[model samples]
Target: MNFTGVSGQLQFDLEKNLIQPAYDVLNIGGTGFRKIGYWSNSSGLSTTEPETLYGKSFNTSTRTPHLYSVIWPGETIATPRGWVFPNNGRPLRIAVPERVSYKDFVSKDKSPPGVRGYCIDIFEAAINLLPYPVPRTYMLYGDGKRNPQYTDLVGQVALNNFDAAVGDVTITTNRTRMVDFTQPYMESGLVVVVPVKQVKSNPWAFLKPFTIEMWLVTGAFFLLVGVVVWILEHRINHEFRGPPREQLMTIFWFSFSTMFFSHRENTVSTLGRLVLIIWLFVVLIINSSYTASLTSILTVQQLTSRIEGIDSLISSNDPIGVQDGSFSWKYLVNELNIAESRLVTLKTMEDYIKALQDGPKRGGVAAIVDELPYIELFMSATKCAFRTVGQEFTKSGWGFAFQRDSPLAVDLSTAILQLSENGDLQKIHNKWLRSSECSMQLNEMDADRLSLTSFWGLFLICGIACFIALAVFFCRILLQYRRFSPETVEGDVEEIELPPRSGRRSLRTASFKNLMDFVDKKEIEIKHMLKRKSSDNKQEASPSSDGKSHSPS
Candidate 1:
């Protein structure tokens, strides 16, 4: 009954003597004899029984019992029972469920007609990491009419129907009770998939980068800079000094045109040039940043959605989609507290698309919630028809399934860990799922837009500079007006001293009139001086003429 020393032994004698003379046989493990079965060349295999076979020798002089045991290469001794069993040498039966999209996971068109996909490639790569080779055969489960649920696929391993169930089989706590799984090779989680509703282009989309307040502030600064430049240069710079209408046009033209660095006015005063320099730099920065931000906003479509995240979908009381029999269904029902009445069960990518297109008002789901792999696959195929919203929730991963206590699980897990670290897993994923059509959409969704908040400090700096320049211009105008006031007169003109009773009224009335009178007096004195100089020149010329006439005689 005990197989103590049979570990190293190649073969053991089943029985010593018999009429037929049966020879040596191999043991399955080093455990006590449990039962035996018969393997015959003609009659076919028979049931295993405890007793051995007996043969008649005619005289019945010798008697022997037929012993039988199953054996293969790479068999190891089972602990406690000391049973010798081959873990890898035998062909492993792998169960694959029938799914059209998932057919790539295990296809019949291949040379051997078996499994191959993101999951299958990962499984084979992990197995290859071991020192020995593993021979395997794939048995597809489910009727051809419908794809099997993940539960039914994993159940095959639990029922001892196959060594493992390999596919996009998700690992969950409920399934863990029935079967053991290796370390997760693919990270999986639920995501909200909504129709990629195109955002209508705003006629004012160009103005979105900066807020209304910012735009208003920017416009005000533009005008302020223009008016300050005109005030400082109007008297000296002829280009700026013109008729009222022409001057008004010049102010605006110079201010706005500076945005494009195409102004015509030339600043003459030192103060005017300083202001212009600062203003020009500010305009350059503003224009450059505005162009950059505006370009980004237009090139990268700004997508907007009613359902920003899972919470929004729930709060809106809109119908939600759950892939039939996916873990997301249970997650929605239990974790999210979504009512069954609101949940719409979807079975395929087409179903997801149809539900989203139908919209919430027409008995369609507002959003579809499913695993990330399926979502990615769906998005890639549809080319931006739908987009995944919200952060992934209820984290889980996909892994190969095995019966509880299977010895291969540990080794397979170890191999998988090695593959993951070596980057083989990512390479497999890329081979199966990578696509370029949706790359722009995916990247655009992830990119952030420029907001007014990003450039508020720059705008503030420009605004402050413009306001200071305006204040300086106004102060200069006031100083010039004071310099021409009558109170500072120094010629022999008598100062009119008002009578005591009329002093207040006289001061108030005469202030403006006296200022005008001073301007008139200055003009008259300039004309008189010119006349006196002209007469003196004429007299000197006449005397010179007389002298020349006498010299000629």
Candidate 2:
């Protein structure tokens, strides 16, 4: 993302079917796929667009009409771990066990550490579907952190060939005849590039002729406006002819000046000037009519205040930006094959955030990041600093990559399944997304929402107080009856007939009668001994449970 200000991460452009092999009929890249994507249908009947469990498109920000969307693959019950055969091009993701995250705290980076990203979400899901310990450090290239060198310096040598096995081998159609795949723990692309141009501290350092697209569009607009004025002058002045017509001269100047930055135009033969004037007026009028249309194409139009999308950032090639060596970069590189010299590599998302605040042109990395929403914020806080390129390039599944054939994947997946079955998956979602202090603040935004001050514990406390008071009141009434009419009925003949409601009742009655007079009679007398301490402003004090002397009011 090229968005500026906020240091965001993980705002990836997610498109369905961007996977390496694309999508086959057997795969999910086709029309059947949906993502942070949407689906809708309309005909003579009606239209529908349902909300998925993520609440994506179900709210006011996204006016998606109601439609039926599936629950998350890992969250759903009755799912097959790996192979149930995809239907309607949807893969069934069944994890073995569900694991909720620690929702109480956010890391210093503002992103959750220990637990993070598509990997965390999909890893938990994959654990339920696959056996674990899937894989160890396969191989490493580039430096592990963003220091003097961001990539693993010695390349594969850094990892000691833990990832040496399958570098380049093509597959024909042989099952048992050759090397095999353990199981695809994850399916996605890989990339990390260098920006082609040097990033300037100030984002707007270069704009003379303006961008190529802007120059063309602006010139055309001016020419069209001149043409319109020329037509109007001609319409009314057809009956007279003169070397100096105010309207015609004004139109000429406006259209001509739009050609370049020079304020004075002195080089032109009489015939050339005439030709230039007529042409300028003609073009200006034509361009004027299409201003709205031209406005849409110019890059500057879209990026007036801040950078708009990912492409501008890449094309700008500021040295400041970097992304992980994930498939997104690979698409921008080897596959998309952006200029190699332009690409810069960073080890993690952390580096991307740190460099975003430099002067616009300083680092030359106008924009850098994988996550989209996070970037939106990152750029916003930076005074609308960067921009984005366009739509998502590819869509792929993210899961915990494991050692080729590890059973631990199965165990983890089982744990995920168990959690999901018992509603733990949802609990985790609510916990992380809703329990934040941010949520508490948001709740206070209106009278209808719950706030931190209105926490449920407060209500529970009130209820307990009421219950205790009621219990005391009832006990008092029971004791009063024993004292007021002890034996008025002791001689009643009817008591003889009922046998005093014996059995358990008789035992209860006897206990109540014996306790009628039994009570804690010791008086806790309070003698007000006001003592003024040296503090001048006296505050009430009392003896604490530990017998510490406390000052009084």
Candidate 3:
């Protein structure tokens, strides 16, 4: 058969003696053109070669012509040649690791082998959202008997052994150099896993938040406030004035009792009341903070790890565990400058748990350093037997791997970003990691305590208020002493005066009479002086006066 510009001529070989139509005309837009067969060259096609074609008839008035196009058997065209799905379909070969954890992605238990898992679910979901159909086949890369390194799994895609590699493979510089990676679907980082130790209850744990010095200083300030209140009120207020021993006892009792709000004594003087008010406020703040801190200490367990962080691991003589062939091994040796002699190589999550349980002294490591995903998975399985400590370091994330410059990489990355923006990625993570059988144990090593620094401002304000009250009381006492001292000195001089006498008896009697009369006159003079002084003070205080008093001095 031969075809030309939408019209073709068909002829049968005389040797075969086959009968067929001589000519057939077809239009692009006419009805009755039904597809019969398609010709696609899957291999060895060039620009100069004739393009593949489909057979159809356009004329309803004539019988459907026998349609045929040149094609080699078992050959087919690729799907969605650019961004659109081909009329037929394209087969996508995906590479996956063969380990038990990753095997779910390509399990063959289903009718024709179906893919399912954290990674596979994401990939399938992304494909469904595409503009066209993409039929895929998952090819297991490693032998089922042994686990493979993520590097080896990704290398298969780099070598074009498969179209793309998808799993928990993390994106790293070395891997990126050989293959392109989509945006990370899972956040990843390194963490330290340590064996859980029993936290013994301390009898005095309530006092752990504040140091001994802080307690002692706090007690001293309480006594000091009490003494200040006593000094301001001792002479005038009966509640404070007493025998030296009784007063000393009262001061200590009131000061310490304020801590518990149990003081029964009341302040009668204004200055004393002011000092008590400031002291009460200070006590209120201190007591409140102490109660909060002590409550936290009692209710929450104090978790302590033998090794606190990566730096601690590096500085100590104790051995540490690093997964063999992992990036962490290189990180410890090169980046952290840790000696290989102090390093113990671990291979799997089981190894990590075993090594930590055995301890550093017994042929095991003090801590295990591995990726956070693995640590989380381990904790999920072991429950409270292990916990992750320290900050996540050497940050990286897990992503799908593809051949360098592969066209699929861009589309896959865009799909992943869209999935993340729409919250589908988070839902997948919750299904896999959050809903897993293993629950994460809480770590309390980082819980904070209330310290003196948190309430020092309250104490400072109280101290200033107390000082002002003390100053006002002292000034009032000094002014009263100056007003009364001169009158007492004048009375002493009047008592020493007496008139001359002849006989001792008459002289004594006359002197006594004169003394009585002089005492009466002096008493009258003192009364007049007191009244005049009081009236003068009132005149001076009156607002109507300009600069002088209206009454005589």
Best by lDDT: 1
* Residue 103 lDDT in candidate 2: 14
TM-score of 1: 0.68
- Note the Cα lDDT for every prediction shown: 0.69, 0.35, 0.66
**Best of the candidates, TM-score:** 1
Q: Order the numbered candidates by TM-score, best leading.
A: 1, 3, 2
Question: Model 3, poorest ten-residue lDDT window?
Answer: 42-51
Please list the residue runs of candidate 2 whose C-alpha ends up more than 4 Å from where it truly belongs after superposition. Answer: 1-320, 324-329, 346-360, 369-389, 407-553
Among residues 3 or more apart in sequence or in different chains, the pairs in candidate 3 whose N, CA or C atoms overlap within 3 Å are 33-57, 80-86, 380-438
**Of models 1 and 2, which has the larger lDDT?**
1
TM-score of each: 0.68, 0.28, 0.68
For model 3, state the Cα shift of residue 201 in Å: 2.4
lDDT of 3 at 505: 64
